[model samples]
Target chain A: MGGATFKGGVHPDYRKELTASLAITAMPAPAKVVIPLQQHIGAPCEALVQVGDTVKLGQKIGESKGFVSAPVHASVSGTVVAIGPYNHPLGRKVEAITIESDGQDTWHEDIKPHGSLESLSPEEIKAIIREAGLVGMGGATFPAHVKLAPPPEKPIDTVIINGAECEPYLTADHRLMLEKPNELVFGLKIMLKALGASVGIIGIENNKPDALRVMRQAVEGEANISVVALPTKYPQGAEKMLIYATTRRKVPSGGLPMDVGVVNHNVGTAVAMCEALHKGKPLVERVVTVTGEGVARPANLMVRIGTLVSEVLKACGGLKETTRKLIIGGPMMGLAQTSADIPVIKGTSGILALTEENVDLSEPSTCIKCAKCVGACPVNLVPTFIAQAAEHELIQRAEKLHAADCIECGCCSFICPSRIPLTQWIRLAKADILERRRQQQK
Target chain B: MQVLYAVAALGGIGILFGVLLALVARFFAVQSDPRVEAVREVLPGANCGACGYAGCTNFAEAVVGGEAKIDGCIPGGSETAKEIAALLGQEAIETVPLVATVFCIGDNRMAKDLFVYDGIQDCAVAMKYANGFKACTYGCLGLGNCVRACPFEAITIGPGGLPVVDKEKCNGCGLCAKACPRNIIQILPKGTAGHLVLCASHDRGKSVTLACEVGCMACKACVKACPQEAITMQDNLAVIDLEKCDDCGECVAACKPGTIHPRRNLPVAAPRPQDQVAV
Candidate 1:
């Protein structure tokens, strides 16, 4: 790449400085952890452990019968106190297993380290990743194993680790790169061997120069791996955008990255893979950036999965009284949390508590045909057209306009001069289009 | 002598230009099917775009091109369909007209709100707040999202803080149904008389009782009362199969919460005269 990164992307204020320099500190596991059965985008797991059953840490508590799904493990060695519905981060009640910590955090008998990465076969690495229930730890929460397993015809030769951390106020991926660069690179090498890809590249935004430098040094002698500094832009870390930025491969419309012989994973997912393979650790924890104007202490903490967001916020000095919005991820694309009682799942990267000063709750007016949203759409969608079509229930027309291709980057909503919820309406249309497609397939 | 010269020059130039213009117009003339003209002449040209085509002319072209049906226009009704069918040497197709109906029975008196929603008056905008202010998440927010969406001005926010659809004015375009954030509006086949469940809330019986008095409790009184087995319980909500519902009105009497009602304003008058169809 030359000067062009990707067409039609917005550059929001990167409020990443709030916790970019903070070291990832381990947050003490709370007394209770409510892990929802479903963490990834695939099927929701069936609770394997019953209420009152004592479980050790790293024990597979939820099992999914579907091949596309990943299993869930206990984050703490404790008794399963409840095995019913609990508040999920995505704003719904999902089946969850709550464990009251016995204060031991003891490992299960089954948790054994896989042999060295170089010694293990590709199939073994895939099995290890699958057993660890590793997902893209990027907010997408797609099962990582499924991503690694491309079809026979589509031969993948490049693996990109997305360290862009493009969303504002998110420093989880940044800190991971800074703290554990070598481990990430090792994980990337493992991914390369698994996919038989000739090259592995780590893509970090220019905003995180230290992370870029550290990651670059980590991969100094590695033959097949290197680091690339991407232009700091919103949605630069999106799968298609990152692939295009690093490999100059434009993922075709309605196609996956694998279609273009490429695969991408997040920096945090790479580190998690290293932990799963080297230390035989299951994905029980992740780095979460707890920051915003409404937080008393902005911090980057290694939070255990299933820990309630309320507990994480408490560890970060609790929320300020002016907090008006609590989000489970970054400001641009995070799901707005209605309550802190929702537990942090595998996909959560940040918990932003924004005060009224940081939020715009003004009334949305009619669109003025200002083409700012159209220009800002990275997918080259006419957001106003899609929004108007959705408003009138002209879903077929919206689908014909390629509404399903939207990445839901929220640029349209951010760029709208009249403050129309363009992204929100387009999201509604996208869902409808997908639903119609599913029906047609049936 | 001067006038003769001027006249001769002007006439000679006019004759040459007229011949050139006639030849150019003939060379560029589009060859179209005569049936397209015939169909276009028969169409009422309401240009409502309800037939999923652009305008009456476009629909006429599509019909002649075998892309559209003769009975696709709702405003033109059966008489227009018969004319178009006869013109095409095809039998007239029988299709019932449809109208929009509000599925929410929860007015201000029946339902409770969690908080005073002083936010934007639009239902979609209101839903961005904690799934809207309604205690019953499935019940109508009564912000009149459908009223504003109705192109025909058929819907109005009644005194009870619920939308009242004027059946006469509605064109059954299904826009209001889409605009209702809770999805509490429906498009159903129109009739002079009918009986239907007025509520669409899917909340459980206990929660529904706590939230709204008019919501379906899933007691299945209407189900038991329906001789045709038209009503069934789905997600604790009573759904009526319009195909089996013969407007018998027995379910209306069995519904204790007035959740089902007979068409209150009976259409005793004859339907509007069909627009003259040209064959």
Candidate 2:
């Protein structure tokens, strides 16, 4: 299929078929949920409610004074059981609020429709979105309001909705597109109004033609909005790549989508935005894809935010006995969890359980000068050279090679003939570089 | 006659270049302090940057230029300090000998791990993943980053998955302390007879009991029993000030988890019998 795509990216087995056709099934509010205070890529929120305080669904429990942070709401009407460090999907213990469900399914009093989309002004729409705690739900978890409010100098002319569910064994975005195309389009309109942008484009991979068709029909009457089928490739849904695929714009190195007069949001984020604007509902629930050969029943379930992964897995018939690796997202870029006790935050898109057959445990062999990793790097980095430099702790050399630009997409590791963990090495180098920069700044 | 001509021509060119090189060498000669070379010669040539300079040469230059202390060479200790001072016609400030000490005693057998870490074999890298899959967040990761960072081969992973510092080999360069992500390794004065706390866990008493067998629970038993009042509770951990501690062994006895021991009793003081025999 002829469609738009960026430069270099690897094509792994797209095992999205397990949950792509499954309808979004609503998993009941779990008996207990662990809501981490810091779910986005900014300042962590401080807990507003203490233990033993009864909270309602959509009640703001955590908020930060920092401008870059977003508020966190209770996913269920429940009593706050604990407020301390808990396991988060990002593989760290963060301050979280544990709540035992009241099982009332009661909405908060403040949750009410503001008005029609046309009735709300641009400023009001942005305010609504900010208060609703909406973030990029495609696992990046960047606060959405910050993206909407770029500096006055960088004017955004186009907004692209990322529907490229490109990662292997993830179909959360695909199912959302097929089920809620109108809400996705309406959400795009609201964003366009908020940013005062003229054009809206929904970019979907060619593998999901049904979603592409439905989205195309959803935007039939709109003049500025269009649906562009992207060539199926890993990381095509990445902000930079998606901007290029949809608008032929190149976001510069170490730059954001706003640098190229564009902004991108995930399909799940758009639907969440629609709910936030129309229903005044906060971000308390999200669709999580639980699938793999190790899962007894692979499914796409509408999981409550802060629900434990163990409970989510249980709702999907639990993990098989042979399951060895439990990942929080897709296999390529997801964090391999050590236990099933982590909570599902806003960024969690998939919970994948891999059996020992898929979990490769062999020690990484030495690189034999094969440039397969170089060919597969989506950011065009020499993975072997960076990995070697990182291995030797040559932070300066790694920095010189622009290791900070790596998106940590795991393309190099997936395509390496030697099974070298190039991505992990690069990640180390990147972390060291960032730490060095932080020290220098101090 | 032809052989004579060829030899004369080649010899003329060679002599001309030789004279030119000599002239260049004389004209572009660099003026350096003679004591810098002498000081560098006396320094331990490890170039470990323990002196806060680039290497031995740079440190020696700094010393000669009055920009660095005469006792800055940590690995060379007081002997090199005296030599440097003598070369500079100054009195040497006696450098105190120091050795590294790994504080945590929670090894693979004593400390429980929350999960098996199966990724990059580096402490810093592992610390970023779920704050390390260790039950105690402040314990040694046993990934051996310190062992790799030690230029003198002073550190090694012991049989129980804890770093053991060889006091004789360690020169208090503080490289291992800097390389450690958990900040559990510390530089202590050598031959100081004092009681040392082996556990660095700042966890509460209940959590400490659940996580490790030898972790400090901050029970204040040592604080109450210390004769010199050397022990104090800080952030759910008991700290013993060596300057005040007199190797009384009372605090060691009072420690419920057996986390405190006499400094000489640690394996770090002397693990090799052959070195002791020679001494």
Candidate 3:
């Protein structure tokens, strides 16, 4: 269809040309891999393997009792050197399994294909997806199975493959769309079948016409599936935004995509699902776009899950001499990394090293009643009022402003003329509000 | 004559407004208990939410409403509790005075600086810059976010670039605890005899040594030396269970980096070095 769009999004300079045309290349696995147990947003997985144990590739190293959590497996056949807290990309020390690879690249004997999609039931597909430990590869890292298993009351009728890749400077999804459109379509069908959805739509940003053409040709014969091009905008690929853009359905406040009978998955996540069910492979490696002005080379490389960010940076010919900010995903919403010692987890979409010029490290100034942030907020919450309440530690006032409804897309911070960190304040307020509610419950 | 007529009309309107205000007050007045006022008179009036209420007035109402105990005013200690108990015909409960303490010992001079973090002045925002500026992630960044959060102006940034809590002025409102991004500020029972571990780092020995000189290396020296069995090794950090602690300074002496802080200003030496040896 034509360009479907969302509301209240900023037009960030999508610097995708750095790696959009480049093909995905395989980066050599590092000697050691630090697989964090708490990769997905849920209860941390308990370590199933211990130090000094020889673990085969694809062997489950960590498993969680919580349904919201997914099991973690060894990306490489190696010996567990340590099972302790390690620095994670999420800016905290988390329990991780550090394994020293034997360089054998051996696969486990249990790694066998599960055959065609026609044979597996929806429950069986979800079980396989869970066992393979697939999560949203689009920087969210939400467990894939959890999204697939919507409540019986909220039956998802449509599944949308999110190939928008709206975040600037991230072309992993773009490269996937170009190189493996068939796999993307196959993965979407698998998800749709698992969700028992009749209609499956792949929503892509119009900026990538090449991707749209390739995806269109891939799903041309499938009547139940279609390709819809979305106008390029920040947060367009966000679950709610994408649902709104394609299907004209607005996910209610404090609700999931399933609330409007829709389920969304990243293109990378779809590819991983196809590999899991069809090839009997697990989510071990993902396509990571290592690009920025600071890097000597800008290309998308298929990287192992537990590889150190330093290794990937080295493969990109290392950072420039004036490199300053090392962002994990995109400059807009990505985390500013302090150290390169963290390993690439399931959610690392892009590794950017912005030089001194690319980064504006200026301090925040006073807010001048501009209301620019109010109009730019994708969630449409009064960001400045919530920020003020949060700054003054007025939890009651912030609660009245619906601080918990913030999606934290960083739109307010990006569009602010005063350069105030409004989104961060809203984030803090949201946490405080949730904490207050939890304490009151206790 | 015209001026007198205008003045007379305005006076008639003013008398009517006064009578209307009196009637509105009589109808809208909340019939609160007389005990609420008596309890509030004895309250500390700090409005420090130590009792989990909104303010002293709210705490007073709760006490009179039978929703709260008379001893809920933490800053008032037992004296105000006794007064409120007497007013409410209840027993006064004893409470230990509490004060906030900065738990991180890695100050500006000691902690390693991985990068020059010149971000927003907020500790929470700065923490978003890779957990914090201090190489020791658990250590306080010493940016004075606590000073800004203190409602009573009880905390100040010391010369060491660390938050120094004035125990006398701190009322254990837990606002500093809320303000701290690293959660280094803790409300501890105020006592001169009690000791505290001044570091929050749980990093392993090598990493801790690399990050900060005074970070707790989890050596368990204090745990082994404590005679009262108060200190325990938890999550690779030394946690003192204050209930069992009797203010013995044994663990303080055993600590090598001087991370264990014995209650200062007390005569902990028992006898002077010169008096015992030189004499």
Candidate 4:
């Protein structure tokens, strides 16, 4: 089918073969876990459990008090050893609950298997998703209920399922599609029902032919749902790119996908939604693809949230002796973690351990202005200009050049011949600009 | 007669169009707030967003509407704050003129090298691998992140592999502080003589002395030696209270390890010769 797509994107080397063939395996639980309260992109959840408080698996350990927040649940039955400031993946100290596991994989009494998605109303579905403590799971970790509920004036007509795991060395979604195709499709239908959308489109990259075939077959009988294989490209899963790819609609600058009558969910998020609705389960565990040259073993594992990254690395047969860098997500957009003590969050798709030889540690040179970043940008932004403005500390000028519109897909930095930290600079500029804008309101 | 007729017809059409334009302008003219325009005129126009607004105009509007205070611009210094205050017909608040100061004194001579850093020259990149090439993990990586972050070309890397601040060119912006991965660059008040602490390290006496020659050892010798008693120990670091310091250069003399050096280019009093020093 001739599906809609966006303009201006680059095809990076897809290195999914390392873990694509590996089926999902449940990793052994760690003894201690540090679950951060401010994992999502909103107000941090307030801690409901104190030190020494015993928490069951899937129990609400932290509760959301504001509109844009998500609740945090315990990944294992454990006693809270500490509920104070701990090391976070962002290289700063944030409030986190350190739990010492009891070795019992016990669930809370409230959790039970429900009948079907048809039984629940829109509000019921949203409550279930919220109680499940589900976020975007697409790396942003924005509250799912917030996206499901658009403003009354703007209507959502279509829901897009993003199966485009475009980042290198990540194949969690690809494996999910290949192994649990029915669950992914079930999740999509639940999301569509919750949003009250008429149509659902699962957009997968052409590189994942096996995933496409399996997903296409799963949706064969459904008239309202269809699967579309997009050209293999980076950031095709971004909200703007996905909207443009499926519906030929452009979400305006500083606007959301709902502005163009659409909503998008990651494939993992869809699966989580189905699990939440049918199994009465919370988003306690997620599939994480652990792969790279530094790792002794490369495989996809269903890991519980709040597990220390060090535990995961150990479970993957530890690291090779030369492992130089430990990243929490895909290489392109993942944050290089300072400490292995940090816990896995809802948005973490992969834990990549790269040796010194594998990591791109090349020195950054002067910008040659090759416009490679401009050519690679799917949103048609001038990344070079933004990086230049950030370098010069001209954050306002950077904002004027649409620095805030940067999806931070790392396309510019990935394609730059100068090896400049263009993405990092732009992120700093965007933060500065946003902070400045906020200060003015006060 | 034909030429005169054509000229008269064109003149009439021009007059009609001019009248229509005038009427449209009169009907659609926006009544802007005079206070906002007045406040905006006095702003520095940098629109750095340090004030938390999109631009100077938005800040001015917020100030005029009484939604914002006049002293929110950190990059504008005290002069701009006074100008903004005058524009709003409010009393000028005495705002501190904050200048970025590099806290580390561990230059090439002070710190020991680890491995020859052959990878990315960024402090952030170097930090990802074994605390950079310095024996002191907290020492400046000398990748010039501050130099790159400076908007006004106020900071540069000296030959000793440390950032040198050009006080003359510095506009007191805090961008350098944000850019430093080590958080060594600090915004201190640009005091009368530009007096401030130079040491950034918080390590103990022996370890700091071993790591870098100029690191603050938290010895408290300067605190005891100061006549004005301006220095205080906080977080295992000696900080000079700028308000109390008389610029006597006593602390400089008292610091045996040379951690509290004078600000660059400050006229330091010459030390007396040993024979002449005897009273």
DockQ of each: 0.11, 0.42, 0.32, 0.07
Candidate ranking (TM-score, best to worst): 2, 3, 1, 4
TM-score of each: 0.75, 0.82, 0.76, 0.74
Model 3 chain B poorest 10 in a row by lDDT: B266-275
Q: List the residue pairs that clash in candidate 1.
A: none
- Deviation of model 1 at B80, angstroms: 9.3
Candidate 2 lDDT, tens digit per residue, B1-279?
A: 999999999999999999999999999998877888888899999999999999999999999999998889999999998989889887533388789999998877677787766667899888887788679989999899899989899998987778988888998888899999999999888885988888888889999999988899989999999999999899999998989988889997888888998888884321223432211
Residue B224 of candidate 1: its Cα lDDT? 99
What level of docking quality does candidate 2 show?
acceptable
Q: Give model 4's clash tally.
A: 5
Model 1 segments beyond 4 Å from truth? Answer: A1-4, B1-133, B143-145, B148-152, B158-161, B164-279
TM-score of candidate 4 relative to the true fold: 0.74
lDDT of 2 by residue, A1-442 (tens): 2276777898988888888899999999999999999999999999999999999999999999887888999999989999999987776679999999999978889999999998989889888888899999999999999899999999999999999988999999999999999999999999999999999999999999899889989999999999999999998988888888888888899999899999999999999999998899999999999999999999999999999999999988999998888998999988888789989999999999998889887777889979988887778889899999999989999999999999998888888888888899999999899999999999
Residue-by-residue lDDT tens digits, candidate 3, B101-172: 788767666677777675457777777766677788898887888899898999988766688888889988
Top-down DockQ ranking? 2, 3, 1, 4
Q: lDDT by residue for model 1 over A1-442, one digit each (tens)?
A: 5234888888888888789889999999899999999999999899898889999999999988887889999999999999898998876689999999999999999988888877998888988899999998988999988888899899999999999989999999999998999889988988998999998988888988898789888989887787888988888999899999998999999899999899999989999999999899999999999999999999999999999999999998999998978899999999876679999999999999998787786778888998999889998999999999988889999998888899999998988889888888888889889999899999
> Weakest 10 consecutive residues, lDDT, candidate 3 chain A?
A1-10
Per-residue accuracy of model 3 over A256-321 as CA lDDT, tens digit each: 888899999999999999999888898899999998899999889999989999988888899889
All models: lDDT?
0.86, 0.89, 0.87, 0.83
